[model samples]
Target chain A: MFVLASASKARQKLLDQIALRHKVIVSDFDETQLQEPDPILKVKLLAKGKADSALKKLIEENHALNTYQALLGCDSLFEFKGEIFEKPINKEQLISRWKRMSGQSGFLHTGHYLISLDNSKSDMESISQNNSCEGVVSTKIEFMNLSNFEINKYASTSEPYNCAGGFAIEGNGGLFIKKIDGCFSNVIGLSLPWLKNNLEKYGLSRLLLDR
Target chain B: MFVLASASKARQKLLDQIALRHKVIVSDFDETQLQEPDPILKVKLLAKGKADSALKKLIEENHALNTYQALLGCDSLFEFKGEIFEKPINKEQLISRWKRMSGQSGFLHTGHYLISLDNSKSDMESISQNNSCEGVVSTKIEFMNLSNFEINKYASTSEPYNCAGGFAIEGNGGLFIKKIDGCFSNVIGLSLPWLKNNLEKYGLSRLLLDR
Candidate 1:
């Protein structure tokens, strides 16, 4: 079993797609307070922060953190024309983002951190020395050459407000996507192939197989 | 307003994505009976046949076919290593197809036919001689290197049984897709960019704008 250290529905849906048994635990990490100059390191640090925060909470709440073999955390960001974009907070920002991103290609970077728990350790001090693995998946996504009317129309809807880069590749905004150049799952929130490759190292690939 | 000449849920969902008001009427044209050596011509002919059949059905049912500006028909096929693949008939075929398609790239060809309906036409005969426009959008899709266990596990699901090439780019099978190189919507059964560009020529792009 695995514990997911995030609250994204897309990540949960992805886990369900692969039939992975997992538990969701929302982290209390404040992402807005985190910042870094490098885009790649930024996401990696955030994912680590989320995992650490979630694990700390589980330990405090007396949850069975040691029962699960692995704890997963993830963070994603959109890079368009040298600028990094997080989720648009309002309709105006979404409209502006779409206008700049229309007919353009951008990179979506998702970072994953897996904390492996040692069940043999009974004390919190020993658990502090747990092994954590990390990986990053980047995908290039191209948006359709949208008209002004189309941009405004999509911005008026609530779809863009809740997604990174003002669009959801798996939702209604899917039609506006022109193409992608890497792991499709990474664009959705996580990379199954990347996860499988990492999980193989821990001898947990069986967890992904058919029940 | 537009009339859709097929019953594919993906196409309907795409129409809804773009906020296009339309009605669906399944074409009676038998896809199995239509075949052409050239993949492009094959899809175009089938799309034309579907549009023609759907227009005739509307006239028979007295559904005011002339009121609509355009009647859209679409058909898609997957070409892997020069062979055409439609929807798999059984699980065995799906497993076999996935074995050959794993870690490979394929072309998804979607043909769209828009029959321009002139409202001035009072009878079926004039409507029968209406002008029609056609376009074909082909997308290159790359599949992840999947293990036999993964392939078999996904093949057992109902997602592979109902889609062309034994996989759906928009469903659970999406995780298995590595990348796409053209119109993403084309792989989903309709090419929105192609459709919007074509619709613009008929002065009907407004139909796609805000209601």
Candidate 2:
């Protein structure tokens, strides 16, 4: 059994693409509490936090799921010239964010964590032995030279507010992207290839082979 | 005016995503004669061929509407390792292709061309001065580990043969992809972000300014 620690539709859709049977659990952890300069590291840390939170919640719920089952967590950040762009809370902020990103290149970092819960309650066991690995995949995006009118109109779509960096490359914000230098799926909120590669390291092939 | 030089449904759907007003023209170009080993250059050359062929046909048929319009053409290629994968012609080849790429990483390259047509014959004298550009965008995709049963089930859906890589990442093939390393649009047979940027050089935006 696989557990996904996220509420993002994009992430869910990415998993669906792989035909992976997984359950979604929204992480209740507060992301704003983390203080980090590097957006990539921040996302990775957040993903780990979400995984830990989810693992605890699942154990407390008395679910029959094996604690040793694979748990997946993900987080994303938009970085432009070393500045992290968080999710916009309002239309005006989204418009301003788009205006700032117009004609500029930015990086979207999506960090993923695969944690295998240890059913055995042993204090001496190493965490690495319990099987946890993390990685961050970054995608570079170039924004089209957008006019204020275009930016305002796109913001009106309300697609930007909930997305990091005030844009959803898979949604209406796609019109503002000029080019992408790295993984496009990362900007869409997940890097599917990276996820598969990481999952393979966690014995995904063996799991499927046994099944 | 934007004129699309192909009748592909996938291309049309992609254009619709940005709400770009475009007229489709079927280019009766001889694609068989232009086969080459270099996949990137081949796609670009094919796109250019389509654009030129459509431009000529439009000029001969609708002389009144043949002024200062930008012609857009696109082509896609699926490459695994160093080998280029074309659309499968038979069920056996399709099955073989899927078996090879079922759980592997592959590259999808989409080449785009924008050719600005001259209205007057006198202006055609300076055809070199007309704004024209070409670019190739690549996206990397990784497929999940698939069973023989899964491969046969998906191949039965008849979605593999029509796509360049024998898979449609946005459709039933999505269930096979584990992750994507490059642009999702490129894998979907077009790169809207790249198109938007290339169009910007012609003072055009994919998003309507007044929308």
Best by DockQ: 1
Expressed as tens digits, the lDDT of each residue in A117-177 for candidate 2 is 5354443123333678888988788787788877877877756777889887766676677
True contact recovery of candidate 2: 0.36
DockQ of 1: 0.44
**Residue-wise lDDT of candidate 2 within B1-211, one digit each (tens)?**
6788988788877777677767899999898999699999999998888877887777768857554457787888898888988888888888888788876888898888777653444454234236678889987787777778767777776677788988886665654676566556778777877777676666665333223
TM-score, A chain, model 1: 0.93
lDDT of 1 at A170: 71
Give the TM-scores of the predictions, in the order they appear. 0.88, 0.72
Q: What is the lDDT of residue A92 in candidate 1?
A: 82
The collision pairs in model 2 are: A17-B174, A184-B182, A192-B179, A193-B179, A193-B180
Candidate 1 residue pairs that clash: none
iRMS for all predictions? 2.8, 4.5
Every candidate's DockQ is 0.44, 0.28
TM-score of 2: 0.72
